[model samples]
Target chain A: MTEHPGRITREDVAHVARLARLRLTDDELDLYTGQLGVILDHAADVASLDLDGVAPTAHAMAVTNVLRSDTPRPGLDRDEVLAAAPEVEQHRFRVPRILGEAP
Target chain B: MDRYQGGGVVTEGWELVIGLEVHCELRTETKLFCGCRNLFGDEPNSNVCPVCLGLPGSLPVLNQRAVELAMAIGTALHCDIRPSTFHRKNYFYPDQAKDYQISQYDEPINVDGWLDLPDGFRVRVERAHLEEDTGKTTHAGASGRIHGADYSLVDYNRSGVPLVEIVSAPDMRTAVQARAYATELRAILIASGASDGKMEEGSMRVDANVSVRRSTDATFGTRCEIKNLNSVRSLGRAIDYEAQRQVALLESGGVVEQQTRHWDEGTGRTETLRSKEEAYDYRYFREPDLVPVVPDAEWKAAVADTLGLMPAQRRARLVELLSGGNGAGGNDGDGDGDGELRVDQIATVVDLGLDDLVVGAVAAGVPATLALARTANEAATDAEAARRLDGSSYVALLTLEASGSLSATQAKVVLGDLLLAGGGDPAMLAKEKGFEAMSADSLVETVGQAVAAEPDAWARYCDGEDKLAQVFVGKVMKATRGQANGKAVVAELQRLRG
Candidate 1:
């Protein structure tokens, strides 16, 4: 996810920061632009290598259909799970008023 | 399935184009990634496990039953099964157990299929992807909207439940076509045994992408995604309102903006919920915990075997039976000779899954048309009892009617009694109801008296005013206390006119 599509620009970093809800100073934005740019360049160098006959890999281990049979079992206690939340109301987790806006 | 050229749900010069995304929950014993019970109406937060709660140190394990159900749904939709990978859809919501929901992104499980409506309109299905459900949140405020809600209560009982999101291409050209597509899709999901397809309980939900364009224009207009359609009726109404809204905007020289709209059932309008920009940016990335799922040939075959006859096929089977062709060709379905054989009635009978009763009766020498009418009208009224009603009893009742032993009025009453009391001899029920066939001489006298009572109408009938048959038949029926056969009365009237 840290890898860029091509080259990472400062504006791209700012947009990513906005989506991540990170309030970064201008200096930090500039710093991450350089940092992510190098990572993208390394990724590009690896991508530029010629290995035409090799199949693409999505995972390192290269396995498929790792599954488990469906069966019901006990879960965490309700009170215990609700206690872990920041707020609880009426036997449920309670959260502050949130806007309809999205990331 | 009536094909819309233009101006079906839009203006005369406009045409509607709609694509639907249907999200249906998978019927499974456990959560998609955990063993916690996937049961609804349970104690709140009782189903929460480490994996579902997104707690650290817990990795997800795909449920085999869930994958099987997804494949079954895909096969029922006639989609090509393929390997799929899960990705994290990043978003922020209080009810989301995970800030990034596990969903299939670019690679989905099913693709490149089409659903045939009973009317034979083929709607191409783009893809059906596997995803997990979110928790339920109820806002506590006057408007019950998140904008002004004081707080929200979250129920994790539904979190991590498996779901299949079936997306359709923009092929529908009217509100009715969109509705037919949704209804057919629901039937397919239920027939595949993948989901219950209950919209009231939120097992199945639909989001419509609707736009209208000039009939002469090749380019599509800006579309809005209408969300929160809980039922099929709401789906049609919302699409109709949204299409009109867009058409109005264009006519007024107001450019339509791309946005997600909310359907307010109470207000009967669609309003902007949020900009499309905020909704589409789901920074998706591959889930490292889960591997890709690829169904082999044998597994795909097994999934395909689970699909039974869907609604469309069932409807065609009934049509074939009605037309006296053993699944050969379509029927006139004009509903003229024997029964009110309208298309919608057939659909209703099939929807209730009662076509078997009609089929059995037809096989037993009862007229198919009469059997269909009784099945669609009387039996459908008490569907549960009718499903349990014996085929022999049904055939006996219809046989009595078809053989002219019992008048249509008496037959209807007998059928109602059979349905209410579970089962009985139809002939005996009619006799108990004092239904005795009027003698031919009495019917002739009754028709003569009826003609004398309305001489002017009789003269007009003799002059070929064909609508007066019901007037004389009514009189004869009343005089004989609904015991006289209508056809006999009509025959007597025709004799007197000649």
Candidate 2:
């Protein structure tokens, strides 16, 4: 994982924001680009470490296989779960027209 | 020079390269990360919880059974089970309330496996990774499609359900081969007891990547992914239609664009849904909530021990049984060379999941051919009942048929009754149904009376009009109210004629 300085461009930020459905303004994109640059710089610094034998860590700790039994427990009431949504219809969470097909 | 005929044209000088991605819902009792019931067709939103709903301050805990099932699936597919981690696939969709999905990235639990189809073509499995399912979205309005819908309703009951996405290498050369791979994979999934492999209920979903290439070329063409294929038939049809569409496009001086297409079952064509440039970049990153999955050797062995006979192995066993041989000594090296009837009988037995019943009958000394026919024909009619049937009772009925104590028709009728009514004494049931076998002495007496009465028909039978034996059998059946065995009557008539 080599460092590529100045790669977090404003255009990249804008494209990612758009994909995330975030309507970011020009100022916001520029601000995020610089912020993202700092984060990438930190990642680059970590990548430049000379620890060849160090294994990549997906989690902060060495914990693995933490799981619960598959037995079912009571879930929230239908009305209670629907109460948190903006709108409810036919015991379901209703939203505006979906713009695109499902992935 | 192998060509396929579809869309009113011979697709000559071209080959289809297809790969399939199948998502199967694990049969866990609860959701993947929450204690909510992982049931289908429940009341909408009833199975949701704060964890699955992605409420603030709620964290997800992996289900132990889900992991074991995943391991079982990996073992069944001959994949290497390794420590795997989950990542967040970032996307914006109404169905995913969390605005992202927790899925495995880079390192999955299973990798580098291959599935050998019944026809003996091996499809390399790239990976089978674990993930969570999204909610259901129902589009309202006239078209009932997302393009022109008033609004969509989301049900979170299915959200956060455990799913394993099995990805295959682009090794299939024909739509038929693709279908065979899916079918065999589904059987493996079922055999592993990890998933129910129900495609119609959305438990199993298949997506295909299809591309066409010149027969002499080695490089692959631009592939288009077909989505929302619900059935194996639809999968095969969509691949064929899409492959032919690409060939026709290239032949007519046009280039096939790499895109995602929707299989329209009504129109029987693949319609463009989205193109490659517009495809969503998932922006995957490691999930900060859950930990990695590392199954130790002991646990892996325990899961491996649960593996049962897969469909292919079961099919081979049934074929051996049908050829009148035991498991060890069955050296019919050419079971595949047998005629199509034997092939179909073996398939019917295995596909119906009744191989164990037939095996049990054979173990009980019943003839293999009779057991295969009974299981495939009579028991297969009601699979649910047949599954619960007592194997010994089935063996007893077949034994009666084999020992000449009951006619074939009487045995079949008895078997059907036993299947519907659950376990009971087969002989007692036969007696209750008035199917008592006719005595040998009485059969001779009846044949004598029939010969004295029907001289003409008897003389015709003696003169080698073998068809006239039916007349005497019919008379015996009429006198005995269908209790006398027709075959016994025919035998007795032959004895008298001699």
lDDT of 2 at B450: 78
Least accurate stretch of 10 residues (summed lDDT) in model 2 chain B?
B1-10
lDDT of each: 0.82, 0.82
Kindly list the per-residue Cα lDDT of model 1 for residues B222-291, writing each as its tens digit: 8899988987888888988898899999999998898889899999899888887744577899999999
Ten consecutive residues with minimal summed lDDT in candidate 1 chain B?
A: B326-335
TM-score of each model, in listed order: 0.76, 0.82
List iRMS (one decimal) for every candidate.
1.9, 1.1
lDDT of 2 by residue, A1-103 (tens): 2334566877788888888778998878777788888888888899888979998887888888889998888878877788788988999889999776777
What is the docking quality class of candidate 1?
A: medium
Model 1 misplacement above 4 A: A1-6, A101-103, B1-7, B278-280, B320-342, B352-498
